[model samples]
Target: MHISRRQLIEGSLCGAAAIALKGYAQPSRWQPGTVRHLLPAVSHDRLLLKASFGRPLAAPPTLRAGPRAATGVRLDSSAEFFSFDLAGLEPEHTYELVLEDAAGAPLCDPWPITMFPGPDAAPDRFRLLVYTCAGGHPATVNSDTDSPYFVSIANRRKMLLTGLSYEPDAMIAVGDHVYWDLRSPVGSVMLGNAPEARRLVGAFTRNLPVPGTDNERKLKRVVTPQISDLYGTDFRSTPVYFVQDDHDYFENDEATEEMVTFPPDDFMLRLARATQRLYYPEFLPDANRPAGLPSSGAADRPAGVSESFGTLRFGRLLEIMMYDCRRYMTLTGPVGGFVPETVEEWLMQRMAAEQTRHVVNLPSTPVGWSAGKWGEWYPDLLQPNGELGTARPKYLWQPGWNRQHNRLLQAASAMSGVPLFLSGDLHALGEGRIMRYGDLDFRGNPVVTVLTGPISSGPRAWPSAWRGTPPRTPTGIELEAGLDPLEKNGFSIIDFTEDRVEGQMFNWKMGEPVENLDNLQPFHRFTAARGA
Candidate 1:
């Protein structure tokens, strides 16, 4: 049965109204929803976990990993969430953690989490699960129907479970973890855009408020289904590194007469930060990482963890320098880039260090593919001829963005390890070898880039559906295409070893039965050997 957009909105509003009435009667600080999600981040000797509860606990819960126990610290910012920071754990050792209430009854099922290998400990192999665009409520912008664009929430959970079954050491979710575009002038099926939609769906207030206030309540209503409801306790075992893109800031990376949403304003930043604090764990601090990086403050956190830039070190084998490109992007023409100069210097320094046997560049925005969006590195515009062309003016795109892009690629190519970059935001699954960048030639050691597939985009959300064009290789860069960008819903499982990195891309298109995903296999695979 086909459901109209208006019908969907009305039904959702009805449910919201019922929830509001129940909350008013209960008068609880936090509404008791069935949304207990756990996100963990780990280092060689420590573990940081952020978990939410369905209801306010009678007292603080405790997490027991073998004989070591850590009491949950209630975050003052969120009512039903707790933080557990445990240090001095044995590296590369699996700890089965049991969460119990103050009364010693099990709160949730026990989960097994493993710490990364120690800094000097050389691990034989490590596996990473990576994907992007896994944000959207099946009932909001899209119905719970199967499409080439999006799948049902149950199916998305199944895919996550399948990936988790692979037992990856860590997971990297590149961007678009949520899809609530609040202030776009363009009419979108995504909730919270237009006035009627905002009113019908719900709106987060303009003012930032303390936790347990009406503002947090409104914010939770908008993000919970997109996040906790979708990933409830499933990733309890795996360490997840979440990088933010435009939509995570509650807007699209769009530039029109009415809005230029990139380089987020203060409210957006605060809202984004607050959402992360409530829903996920921030990137754990690294000793060598600069303390002054964006959001690397001790405020409300145990220590200074970088909310924007992060480093994932798996012993002496792999180091992934992941940076959020949307938070600190500037618009100063030739002087502006996706990240600030300070961050660029840090990234370049890390690339030069080569402390690990393998170094992969993980950024929110992809390097090889472009849908001609305004926020890309290249100044290519989507021409009326349905092609991307640099001859046309791309509004608000800076020359410095491309310059930074070239510099980063060149640095990666110069490194001793295979120049492999895994990125998101392209809404596709593809791989290409970037052999040249304008005047720069890297034929001797070409840089390889991959688009880790989208997790939750439905038919209407694809670039071809919304922007009127499929992603293409940007002009002026010669790319030897391995898997030309294919719009689908899937992810990549990458295995890293001392001498090589291997990847398998698994995806499913429109009209496919969701049940098929239970036994999905890789559609494409590739391997990059270590540098001599």
Candidate 2:
């Protein structure tokens, strides 16, 4: 049953006739099809959701979260996006929420979905498929006639489908999910003044998608297809959690100058909120978080706990803390890194709680790697040796950032159970353990960090510190050698039981099974105990 690429062409883009092949073109917005797409599904506690995209006929559409049927809520935007949120659904249970146009025609292709497991149920084992930095600009930017490689795009779609084949309980997208390096605004147009800030903000957003704006339509054209191609039917079945990193939110690792000059209340603030509101799922605002969408409007900004950061508890086996590395201190101008103060406090509190047995922190940035002042780190930290225009960047080795990071290490050490941090951002796959910083006496909790990444992004330059024969860590961390730098284009499949966890990194060859990663090929594996 081998099919050639020529046989899979969808439309004239390849100068080929329409795919008229029923299933291939059946779920497209532009192609003559019955359905357009099944929007990326999201989970909130026990609730599971899915939506459809197509022409909105006169009567409002209806949906069923399995048997719980309700009228669809149309999200007003460039095009109609109807959603169904199935409340009170049992955790760890499966459902197929169907959407029907007024004529009773189902909008989604048949798919089975499961809700996030609840607190009361403790599954003996759970699996996760993790990766990050799969980003590229709009595909249309390529030639109207010539065929573009689309290497990253094709690889990303491949990665997701393969990850799903393992039946991972959830998919953790560790940020850089969407790159904002498209067309950024010029800095000269911005100033601290409200008017100038507004003008600059407008310029920045000219190419971005803002809900309810005409640009949204253009955005859906590019974005919707990407979602459909990458996630396919699995996104509807699994609980996929997205971590919004620098690229997903704004310009590549964007930190606006106006934001620094005027703080969070500036025009850049508005843009941040607007983009978030339109694109992502709803997040319950933490009370410790300030009363703003993007910025706090105050100098004493809270930690990175918002819709972007929260907790996911899985039947007492794991206390999962969501991490948002970019938003914590990126907007304030200072190159300071680490989770916000409030967020740290909350996570520590959770980790030390009586019921907390295993603690898991999922961050966008890799958990290891310290900086030596010469400026290779993105935001140069205060260094003994100066570099990067600003010599006082607050990198991990610097006192401010170091203290915050050390505090996290301290909490992890003091915890009675294993503290595991999983992350992306860096385009390399590796694992390490953070020892208590000697400076922080008695901070000796064993903290483990496993990094998976760059499903379709660049093969990053491995950090000099991590490239040693045995792999190195700045003073406070030690490398876990069995699996270090699975540098090929791949993703990590992690399976966890109550006492131990095993991970395998897999790469796919071109023309491999669309539904599988061909795991029999070159792969890297690692295992660790719950706590040592």
Candidate 3:
């Protein structure tokens, strides 16, 4: 039975009318006819498996592991997400997808998902491409097409596709997947004269414009910009473990205090929520409920909503802790709020339990960018502070809250013996080691922090380098210029094996490798014990 758009529309209207007349209500679990397509069931290759999203929604309409066929497994709700254990799949094989309807009928369309067997068993290597701050431009007075930014992002995406040809495990996008509130003129012709290109860029801006509107035309204009000359589909299908940054919410440095006073107009939040619905695959289950609602029983659950932060574990070797810094952070000036005390406590508890060999903290904001410089600038906002002008202080350059965040970092490093901290948001790629007492004090272990900047956004070079200064704490680590011109926007690929981890920062523009301070040509490799 082919379902046309008109038929689907008619069916939807009829279904709604039927429900209203019969006083039928949505069920806690989805009914067969509620949605057009049901998500595929998933299973992992190993018996010991754990998966989580931010919400209780079903898994994506499709699932991918390795290239092998995955056996159908029952999914159980763990409050945060649906978890599936793949107890009967072959090890070291790529598990493609297994589709099934609510009644367990095979959906018949198979999409391949790649999963790597644990490095614990053999010397297996997997590459992960991490990036952020794409899909929107700042409200600056630049005229040219800034093709470098777009070209760089396209190169990175191409590189990922190239890596996938080699079958890497996953790509971790460390937040800001789509910047919703960037500024661009409406219908303004592109100075570059690429009308189609201009339209694509314009679409992204219109989709989630700042001080948002409910009109569909405006939102569509922002997201599906006129970038036909640049590329098509906006790099949508690249599999990514996405976490939400401040841009995903509305603006930068937005916190509970600022939200209260300058709450996004209802239309803006709605628009943001809609964009999230369209882009992100899954969210934390707890974030599905309305704000301030009790966890156990919520009568008015918002439809198609989810949280953007959580954690996922790959056996006992690796644990990815994705944090929502924007949701809980405080603005820079008056109110000195940081992560809510409760979330902080939860994070601490999670960090204290140290079973994994490596822990990666993915915060939207770079954990340690200096106070003065981070975001792009606009002439309209008045400058407040010194060289670190307070102009547009409300959005970025939030130093006051760093006191609390710094402690959180210290605690995380102290508790978890994890060596690497992966982050994005500075729009520049830089790597540093977190030290203690002004020296290499890694609490009896070695830890390295790798920051990868924006995928497609222009690099704020001068301010980024100025802000890249290491913190001045007694435990402050020395900042060696790992890869100079980190300002050239790009992504970092980290390959992990049982014995060592190799980190490579790829320059998207030149399509080549970047060397660290050690002068290792092409790629930078760091060897450490699995647990150290």
Candidate 4:
């Protein structure tokens, strides 16, 4: 066991040579058991620290914290995470992150992160940059090397740089952080095995179909290759609050039962639980947790965890009610899916008691897309006569689900007196006002729903259903498409002050501002008075 340095070196060389001959060699630059790099260690004094790649190394490394020169010095553990406590820090403070390997070798070029204080600290003033659906196949191999799949340290750096430049308090990742393994017509590669440390595997892959390609044979070969190079790198970072969408759990328009065609059996349900553990940092209240069906006489049943859906309070001014529509929603069918009775009651109570000036409903899917024209009938759901029969309509823009959730939104807008609906699903951005009819619940009080498309995926046009919709202006409900430029990939920002709330959209690649107008197509802006 106590081998000499020379002997160790010689042995490593012989092993490497043998592997190279077998075409299974690692890069020469990396040696077996030699530490590659170290992440910035988490410290007690630090408000927040982000981990890019997966699990921290065995032995924790040292890092500098606090201000320069007279900054406080501390040691950090590699196991747990660091926090950014809003209470302790002031608004608009810039901090630098420096990472190194065990031997003190620098890992990445140094980067700076700025902390923005919330509206509480600045009197009804806060800013947030919203981004969703990024990270697919890269333009070239060079981009791949520079920025790998989910945990693209380079792309994150760019996002942070742009976010800081605009000085946002928080960033909202709408959903679809990673796509599960699915074949695509595009040449985008799929990730290999999921990381063992995190128990989740193959949850995120590149599945977006490549545009404008006619040859299907060539596309299949190129897209089928396993991307073993970028697996196991931890990409989930920042304080992201997300819900499970179809792509996040399975292929587009795929139902839970249809997912059984794939391996691992109940892929969608299993991945749903696994994804919650791997990515989310928060937990749901015990009362609302999911309980799997009871075991029968012959077999043991699978256990279940509560779905992630609840309200988050940001001071007294903002209340975010996040919904897990996927969990309760039914697949495309005739019998409408019902929100678990418990969830509906809870939502109703929250809306009735909400005292916050702004109540934001973050649903994974939008409320407006109707089925007749905007919805597509999957091959499996078609009949022999080529006519489509109604399947179980669980939140697939069926009239029932829409009416239910819309009523909840209407109540929040009327009771709390302030409502803004933030949604993301279709890779296109749009804004519109909700129309009300009879009572204040769903009739008179109107709510504004703004849809922000995918951050890095293909940009799509708003479905025809969203267009030609009328605005219930007196009730303050309207619908319009936000900044969604086909040629650009980007996100949206909301800046709030005591008097007004400023909504802006930005292009992540160019790091420029976009106007909130139809001419810009997908990108546009509109401001609502703080108390409106």
> Model 1 off-target regions past 4 Å?
1-35, 76-78, 142-150, 187-189, 194-201
lDDT of 3 by residue, 1-532 (tens): 1222223222222222223222343332212222222212111243211222223334332233444223323232222222232444553444434444444454333333333334244324445656665554222223465444233433433433333332334556666554444321221222211344345434333344332233444443454331111122212112345666655544443223323312234444555554443333343232212333212122222222134455444555555666656554554443343445555565566567655555666666564334432321111122343332234553443444545555566666675355566787666677765554243255554445676755565443223333443222111434433443255555666766655567766544333442121121233334334453
Model 3 off-target regions past 4 Å?
A: 1-109, 114-127, 136-149, 152-156, 180-217, 224-239, 250-268, 284-306, 332-338, 374-400, 437-447, 459-477, 510-523, 527-532
Runs in model 4 lying further than 4 Å from the true structure: 1-56, 59-123, 137-160, 181-238, 255-265, 283-307, 331-339, 370-399, 436-444, 459-488, 507-523, 530-532
TM-score of each: 0.90, 0.72, 0.59, 0.55
| Between candidates 1 and 3, the TM-score winner | 1
lDDT of each: 0.79, 0.50, 0.42, 0.40
Ranking by TM-score: 1, 2, 3, 4
- Score candidate 1 by lDDT: 0.79
lDDT of 3: 0.42
What is the Å distance of residue 456 in model 1 from its true position? 0.5
Best by lDDT: 1
Q: Which residue pairs in model 1 clash with each other?
A: 148-510, 149-458, 149-459, 150-458
The candidate, 2 or 4, that scores higher on lDDT is 2
Q: For residue 246, what is the lDDT in candidate 1?
A: 88
